[model samples]
Target: MLLKIDVASTVPLYQQIHDQIILGLASGQLQPDEALPAVRQLADELAVNMLTVAKGYNLLKAEGYLISDRRQGTRVAANFQADAVFMQALQEQLHQLTAAAKIRGLDVKDVQELVAAQYQSFEGE
Candidate 1:
């Protein structure tokens, strides 16, 4: 997967990496059981610190989006389920985003359309 990191953005490098990987999975650019580069290798390719890559990988592993073993190195988890904890967090985030959209003068239909467009983009990918 190709990760594009914006050095000028306020977001941290590791977060960019983490978010991009998730996007890749959502877009089908990454598949279940797909192997990922080693920490050192990805760090070198991204011209970032190895620790940064490891931190992102570790977070994904902890979140059950990835798995690591000596035999397979690091690979996408073969199965991932959105448990209640994740669902709650997602609902909270959506609530915040919807509130922000309302404050910005976006009607419900506008927000729904925007959401549909984004969802369709993922589907097309």
Candidate 2:
């Protein structure tokens, strides 16, 4: 997986890594059960601290998006399901985004179209 980190962005490095991995999974660029680089290896490649990469990996593991074993290393979780906690979080995020769009005077149809485009991009992946 190629993860692009915007060092100049206000977003935290770990969060960027976490989000990119999620996008990769959604776009099917990263496949189920695919082994990810070791934390240290990824850190070195991304020129970030190992702890940052580890933190991202740990968060994904806790969210059931990844699994790690001493013998097998870390791999994308296969047959992952969106549990209730994840669904609630997703709804909250959508709520915030919708509010932001409204505040910016974006029409509902515009927002819906943007959403549809993104949703369709993930299709047949």
Candidate 3:
């Protein structure tokens, strides 16, 4: 998987990394049991500090999207589940996105069509 960092963005480097990783997982670009790059390696590639990469990795681990061990390194969780907390957070994000769409004069059907297209795009991939 390829990861990119936007140095000038308002989002923190670690967060941008974390978000991309999450999207990869959700979109099936990163598969279960897949090995992730070593923190040092990823940091070097992204031109960021090791600690920054570690922070993102730790967050993913805590969120149950990744598993890390000395012998196996870090891999995507083999059996991941989106628990109540995760669902709630996801719902809030969707609400915010839909609200923005509405403010931009997108009707409910327009938003639904966009959502459907995005969901189908993932399936085609």
Candidate 4:
């Protein structure tokens, strides 16, 4: 899998990395049991601090998206319960979207249609 980082954005580098990793897993770009780049290796490759990559991996581990050990280094969590992960992420996005839509006078039907249309673009990808 390829990981990209943009430094100028308001989001922290580590957060951006972590979010993309989660997105990758959700989209099945990275399979369960896939090995992740070591913190030092990724940091060197990305030209970012090692601590940043470590922080991202730590957060993923804490969230059960990654399992790390000294010998294995780090790998995607073996628990491939896609339904739970995808739905949880979807629900979190919905919560944020709902708050924004409320301020803009949009409702559930509008959000539902928007999501359905967007998801259609991902069919069989």
Tell how far residue 42 is off in model 1, in angstroms: 0.4
Instruction: Write the number of the candidate with greater TM-score, choosing between 1 and 4.
Output: 1
Query: Pairs clashing in candidate 1?
Result: none
Candidate 1 overall Cα lDDT vs. reference?
0.94
lDDT of 2: 0.96
Writing each residue's lDDT as its tens digit, candidate 1 over 14-111 gives 99999999999999999999999999999999999999999999999988899999988999999989998789878999999999999999999999
lDDT for each residue of candidate 2 in 42-108, tens digit (9 for 90 to 100): 9999999999999999999999999999999999999788789999999999999999999999999
lDDT of candidate 1 at residue 62, scale 0 to 100: 85
Q: Which portions of model 4 show Cα errors greater than 4 Å?
A: 80-93, 117-123
- Superposition TM-score, candidate 1 onto the true structure: 0.94
Off by over 4 Å in 3: none
Pick by TM-score: 3 or 4, better one: 3
Report the lDDT tens digits of candidate 4 across residue range 23-99.
88867798899999999999999999999999999988878899988899899998956478778987898899889
- Please report how far candidate 2 places residue 30 from its true position, in Å: 0.5
Clashing pairs in 3: none
Worst 10 residues of 4 by lDDT: 116-125
Name the weakest run of 10 consecutive residues (lDDT summed) in model 2. 116-125
**Relative to the unseen true structure, what is the C-alpha lDDT of residue 123 in candidate 1, on a scale of 0 to 100?**
93
User: Per-prediction TM-score, please?
Assistant: 0.94, 0.94, 0.89, 0.83
Full-model lDDT for every candidate: 0.94, 0.96, 0.92, 0.88
Residue 77, model 3: lDDT of 93
Clash number for every model? 0, 0, 0, 0
